[model samples]
Target chain A: MATSTTRLPRAVDPNTVNGWGVDADPRNDPTYPFRDRSREDGPGMAWQRPPLQEPRVEVLRSIEHSRLPAVVGTSTPPKGLSGMIRRAAFRYSESDWRHWLMLLGADRINVVEGIFEDLARGRIPNIPAEMGARAEWRHNKLGLVRKVAIVAAVSAVAVALLRRRGRDDW
Target chain B: MLAAEYRGPYRMRAGRKRMPRIEHPRDALVRVTRSCICGSDLHLYRGMVPDTRVGMVFGHEFCGIVEEVGPEVEKLKPGDHVLVPFNIACGQCHFCKQGLFGNCHEANAEATAVGGIFGYSHTAGGYDGGQAEYARVPYADVGPTVIPDWMDLDDAVMLTDVVPTGYQAAEMGGIQKGDTVVVFGAGPVGIMAARCAWLFGAGRVIVIDHLHYRLDFARRYCPAEVYDFREIEDMAVFVKKQTDSLGADVCIDAVGGDAAGSALHTLFGKAMKLEAGSAIALHWAINSVKKGGIVSIVGVYGPTGNMIPIGNVLNKGITIRANQASVKRLLPRLIEHVQAGRIDPKALITHRMSLEDVSDGYHIFSAKLDGCIKPVLYPNGGQ
Candidate 1:
């Protein structure tokens, strides 16, 4: 609940909003209420696109946006077994984890309980650069190779089944 | 700069927030005048909706004065009073062109489960909502409409969501002349749907809810026949008997997940998370509708499966139509209805609070304390 010092936009003339009252000409259509001032100054209305700006300040939620490998499935995990059980029972439900994994494009079974712990703790730990720690992070926590293999196997099975179903239906 | 924050399920903290600024040329900064705690917001508050990130602001039903306009913004300008639809739509998208503004393609990059919804989770779109003193509105030209000078501000705010959602619920029912329609759930949407059913030439409308207060409110507001599900021995059978064993012509599911009734449904759906919260209301809707009847769902279901009786729908030859209400598409006729005194949208407001007291607003509404039907938040503290 932090505050920003940004000032509010200044108001234009009350009488001549959107070039309506003071600037209305006989040649201009009266039925049309007002012309956009943004159009008058810049690239007119036709080619105008929504310009992208700097990304907004990220809100620090209970869950971090990035992957927390150090805390995810490492040997030295953050929470106790009872704490994990409590979270599973009380704070974040099974459905929430499943939904989170699905949205994160990760396998539900592969996601470790430490990921939930990290979420509960409200801080994302950075990945260690040491070779052994990196190996553990890669092999134990993410298991990227296994994930890819599982995905490929699943896709192959799904394709084979779909083809078989199509043949049977025909 | 006060805003409502999602601390966790059933916990909201109202405190100071960083002022939102225009992040895109299509974005406009709105100084929120009126924002309401919607029933769907309760779903997020209750931890029903997925990806409801903590530290998220949670008010989608709000109207405000345009504090600033982006460079590319054409229609709206500074100082205009505007009502913003919950669904954000990029006007040039395929869905928006088809008047399917709810499913706008460009506004939300996520899968098509939902479009960009203000203050909804990242599942909808990560954009902030109008629950605070200032909110960044994207695609401002498409979703926001100026509040007409003659319209009451409270009524104008309702049109942004609740009014149109209810109207769309009834509209989706395809209620023919003299059709007997039964609406499930007596919340604001259900009541509005039942009321709108009359305008669609419904012969009789019946609303069901377990809560006596809501049923009573439904009866008073919509003037529809009311029933408490707790009193009824069987919902499907009761509706059938009311309609001479044929069931009602159409049924609407206004209650989504977190519906209470069967203990098994609660255990499996809510507790187990095997499926979306108790599909009890949806099951009742499907079972209670007559053969060849339509079931319109405006209820807020979660981002996953539901154990609904699809076999019943198949056997009964039911037509199911469900979507988020296309508020922009239905606004013109609804504005006419509201202006002509046919629908009193503001009559539903039961409590009003300043944005500083938003957590209290969420508590009273969620707990159903103080006979609260609808609670509106005033960011500028006018009312």
Candidate 2:
């Protein structure tokens, strides 16, 4: 009943949102969920045969000997989609584009990281009991840290401006 | 050193909830009084175990106090200080009784088809790990070890892993009263392998590692000759130069990855006397033998494959034997050596730590992995 007459803040124009960037629904807008396509088969079945021993033999052959050393000690800084694009450009070739590679790496790892965070948090959302039962998990690299940082920084800025006006209103 | 929980590659978070308690009736609750982050643990850390759920208590090498026991568990009681054998062997199994505990059907069945472990993958049978406040010890009578109150938990912890593993390597090495042996990879296990080689009567023990720290230890602590691989490029050329260009009587690839393998070629490149990868002692035993020589493997292998040529393996006419070390059988002897001061797997213990300092423990050690050989953790120092 209190919702009957409550005033709402005006919505931001889509053209002006986040510096006029395209508002793509990252979770489901066609290119979302990061499907490999090579692995899709109806719904649930994603697990391959599990290793029978300690040294997991076949971990992504394409990511051979050198790929491991690629992101050994990394930390990412968030700068939005444009920032991510810029970082990827830089990593591929030397130019004003180098920063793009960092963004790309961050963006790529972040998408994977977000879905993975729940598992990292030990939520154990309806999986084979044995999956969560093991002793180790992967690590969060610089990318997720960057995204979280950007979110924090944006919120902090928004709060600061509202405070400057000396009003509780946004 | 750092046994943080992981979700997959790049999804590590600080665990907030206290890890779960022993849930099953057959479980034996053992607080991880002493544990270490194993090299194998990194695979899970790297996200190889897909479906890897979060909140994994990561660690396996440990010695602990019996905090609680399952209702059916009559062999152990509280206050008993013990070492957890890396694999949970069901003493009732055929292979377990025959000393092939690693392949015991029940033991392997319980661990990701490979059986239960302290802190390992679902493949090892999804038992929760010991890296946290506690672990659920399955097949209790068979895997939980009994150590004395006087023994340092650090030394006892090796019985859970490298001590037996190293001794098993020597036993597989099949050394007579006197023989020449060369072991690759001076990581803690390699050093221990060399030490055990000396104990097994290797007239000449040569250890190979790129790290100066480990080779220096080998030179100073053990009687084995040391070969710092950083100085050498070719395995055959380097090893041969060391043994009058004849190659070692037994060559052990304590080194993982490219130690003996050339992945680019999908075959063995320059021939070395012995080979070891998925099975370090076994490769050495099989290929690096003296026509009738024995090779023993005690290294760790996950799902990775060793591109060994089986025909050549047979043609070599050598003795090859490797498996998960029979930890229970080897522990008592390893303890006697530790007690007798004949060997100090403890000296291999370069990092001494407590649970609170795990971050530093994981880092400094993880940073210089090959350099920071063995680290021992103690949760409760009371004992």
- The model with the greatest DockQ is 1
Task: For residues B130-221, write the lDDT of model 1, one tens digit per residue.
Answer: 88888888888899999999999999999989998998887778766556778988888888988887777565678989888888898777
Q: Could you tell me the TM-score of candidate 2?
A: 0.64
Q: What lDDT tens digits, residue by residue, belong to model 2 across residues A8-51?
A: 22112222211111111213211211334553443432223211
Ten contiguous residues minimizing lDDT sum, candidate 1 chain B: B105-114
Write down the worst ten-residue block by lDDT for model 1 chain A: A68-77
- CA RMSD per model (angstroms): 18.6, 23.1
Instruction: Give me the TM-scores of chain B across the candidates.
Output: 0.98, 0.84
Candidate 2: residue B161 lDDT (0-100): 76
Q: Which ten residues in a row have the lowest lDDT in candidate 2 chain A?
A: A67-76
Instruction: Report the Cα lDDT for residue B240, model 2.
Output: 48
- Per-structure clash totals for the candidates: 0, 52
Instruction: State which candidate has the highest TM-score.
Output: 1
